[model samples]
Target: MKNQYQVHCDHIDVALPYARNSGDGALIGSMFGVCANGGANGADDVLVVKGVFTLTKNSAEAWTVGEKVYWDNVAKNVTTTATSNTLIGVAILDAANPSSTGVVRLNGSFS
Candidate 1:
């Protein structure tokens, strides 16, 4: 483990946006990561990345496994549509309906 190059990690905890819940897969910019160790708004908590997270989904449309998912900032839910949406990652599990949670893989890149 000497001089090992690390890639993904969950040790970083940064300030959470105002009123942002500690739910897994909560959209943080283009990436959909959440602070598992729930914290108050504007406080720091454990930020977990690179894992399957159950997140809120837009129930208006059904989703299948491997579908491209986007963060609907307006609705505060994950959607399959990309119109005016921020690409978060792909769905690893199917969300049969809206107002439910689906598992997503965190693979969005930072720009």
Candidate 2:
């Protein structure tokens, strides 16, 4: 492997082995690059990534947004509703700590 480093992120995705129930309805993460502990041991507290954009403030519940969202699997934190989902304006903010490793697929708002 090359060099891997995680930074502050706003909208990202993570894969954990368990699921979490944080009522904040928002977290933070970094863009996809690569990590050492990047594993596929799906967790339960996961944000349940999918094509659904309807993420709500409810824990483990999916809600809809306008622009973007961030899901931290390891830390089980999340943040939704952004301005732009482009790679240029990628938003990533560091969580209380960090999150697990997973795919960070970007999506767009409906027209």
Candidate 3:
């Protein structure tokens, strides 16, 4: 047990984006985690970096299994477009066209 070491912490505190109030979710870099507990204005709140999250999407296009997904910072939704988007992760399940959300298998945390 002495040699045991942990690599990453899934939950951490991150500052909320401008105009994004506490309890709201955000996409920080490649991370698409949520805020919980309590925090406000430049303060660090809980951010979950891994898991299957059901987030809002473009809703105009359908998602296929294993398709690469990206986070649209401006639109604040999951999208298939890579241009000007943050690579969040991959779509684990398929979403029918015109849907509002999709299940994403989030990648593990980084430094």
Candidate 4:
């Protein structure tokens, strides 16, 4: 097909919305993905849009497996709170309060 460029879209190259480190989760205008490399804001970088990853989360909040999670862009971490945040994925494992990380599977698309 003339319109076909590439098939798989599990990853994408985008101008970063903010400075990021490798493995950082980013939400660029409703699209969410994990940074494949670290770069300054506005730099073009590959974002992995699918997979399970251990990401930094709110240490004060606990998470249960299968619970929907959101990206706290201001805090630069994951949270269970839905208010004013972007939904990124679901927790794959339970996380305890004061824990610094949580396992998540990226949804690859917004609800």
lDDT winner: 4
Per TM-score, the best of the predicted structures is: 4
Ranking by TM-score: 4, 3, 1, 2
- Superposed by TM-score, candidate 2 places the C-alpha of residue 54 at a distance from the truth, in angstroms, of 4.4
Pairs of residues clashing in candidate 4: none
TM-scores for all candidates: the values are 0.76, 0.22, 0.77, 0.94
lDDT against the true structure, per candidate, is 0.70, 0.30, 0.74, 0.92
Over 1-111, each residue of candidate 4 has an lDDT whose tens digit, in order, gives 899765778888889999999999888888999999969999999899889999999999999999999999899999999999999999999999999999999998464
Supply candidate 4's per-residue lDDT for 95.
99
Cα-lDDT of candidate 1: 0.70
Write down the TM-score for model 2: 0.22
lDDT of 3 at 97: 90
lDDT (10s digit) by residue, model 1, range 1-111? 777555556545567664566674455665556667776667776667666788888877788889988878788777888999888778997778654778888663331
Cα lDDT tens digits, model 3, 22-74, are 43457666666655654555676777777777878899989999999887879
Spell out the clash pairs found in candidate 3: none
What is candidate 2's lDDT per residue for 4-99, written digit by digit as tens?
A: 343324223555433223322222243322222333345223232222322222144233323234443344433442333212112232222123
Model 4 earns a TM-score of 0.94
Ranking by lDDT: 4, 3, 1, 2
Clashes of 3: 0
